[model samples]
Target: MPMNDADAHVAAQIRAVLAAAEAGGGVAPIVEAGDPILRQTTRPFDGQVDDAELAQLAEVMRATMLAAPGVGLAGPQVGIGLSMFVAEDPGSLDPETAEVRQRSPMPLRVVLNAEYTPATSENVAFFEGCLSIPGYQAVVARPRSIELTGVDLNGTPIAEVVAGWSARIVAHETDHLDGIMYLDKAEMRSLSTNTSVAKFWNQPSTQQAASELGFTLPSSMLL
Candidate 1:
């Protein structure tokens, strides 16, 4: 049965509180793709960062994301639609050279009421898997650069143009707040099971998938 407004609110509060109280602020279970929450837009967060409940929720989200080992996560993925998400990318890999790129690790960041726009016309494809989706991945074509704007946990304004892998993470988490999933933009033919990806398509770039699996690479991703 679908949740009513009051029931959903109560459930969200309970989840946030329980997630906050778990030892070390344990990871929350990610809501799966078919959940209504994942498909709906989130409400604005009007609560102050200093608010005890809000801070606790943030901590819980951070703990959960790191525990899941995901670079980004959205509130809806955790059964809340509070226009909140967290992201942190520890490193990057150069797809062609198989070289680890040196980039500053983003400490856990909370983006609320986030907005993103393409910073460039170029599109690139890459294999993306969502925590909610579990064991499947797909090649998604996304803008190569993005201008992201949002508020931090403390409600501080953030505005920046980001590119490369960083831009991908930003666009991804922001899309969650907008009721979009990578699958919605993914190449249908490029879908693969996680096991298949590990055995066949799990290279640094999307190029391997194009050649091995007959997936189409966005022009920007072509050599």
Candidate 2:
């Protein structure tokens, strides 16, 4: 889809800020939950955010995500209410041993005005975390596979079928664009502090959360 003109002046201001961040400036502050910005539905990037400006935003966001050491970040998290988000999961690691588990790797990528369709009836649940909602995780369930559609910074289209952790990351970030957070889909009783997660629910699968944590995990997620 094509973009229209938004507040042109707002666009210019953001362009300059993003450019500065791209040039080794400070990372944009992440907005936390209960902030009105995170609750507001983001608008599609109008012509106001030109391709060059969009590219700069992507770079800065990527840098911030890597610096935060998170697998995903969204525009709203950075106080930009635009329909854009970034996600990358190179692999998983053992925090104690620093041993990397070769999970499916997703290189850094940005998607704008993203939309997705569930490609499978099966559901997958995992203990997911977020940058905005730091130091905690919850069991969130979603389609095991999905067809994601969106655009890059250059106004081109992007479409792909993704599965595993990649699908979870895509679903989580796109939810931010829609003013939705992972907590919305998370099993409330399964929520845990980071330390609690490490202690009680840090098993190979969330199937243990039900028995050890005394929470209900959907049967579909048990493999």
Best by lDDT: 2
Each candidate: how many clashes? Answer: 0, 0
Q: Clashing pairs in model 1? A: none
Candidate 1 wrong stretches, greater than 4 Å: 1-25, 48-50, 93-104
TM-score of each: 0.85, 0.86
Q: lDDT by residue for model 2 over 66-109, one digit each (tens)?
A: 88889999888887778889888876665422121114768888
**lDDT of candidate model 2 versus the reference:** 0.78
Q: Report the poorest 10 consecutive residues by lDDT, candidate 1.
A: 95-104
State the weakest 10-residue window (summed lDDT) of model 2: 94-103
Task: Give the number of the best model, judged by TM-score.
Answer: 2
RMSD (Cα, Å) of model 1 = 4.3
Q: 76-169, model 1: which lDDT tens digit per residue?
A: 8878877888888876554452242213456667888889999999887777889889899898877878899888777799898887767778
User: How accurate locally is residue 40 in candidate 1, as Cα lDDT from 0 to 100?
Assistant: 86
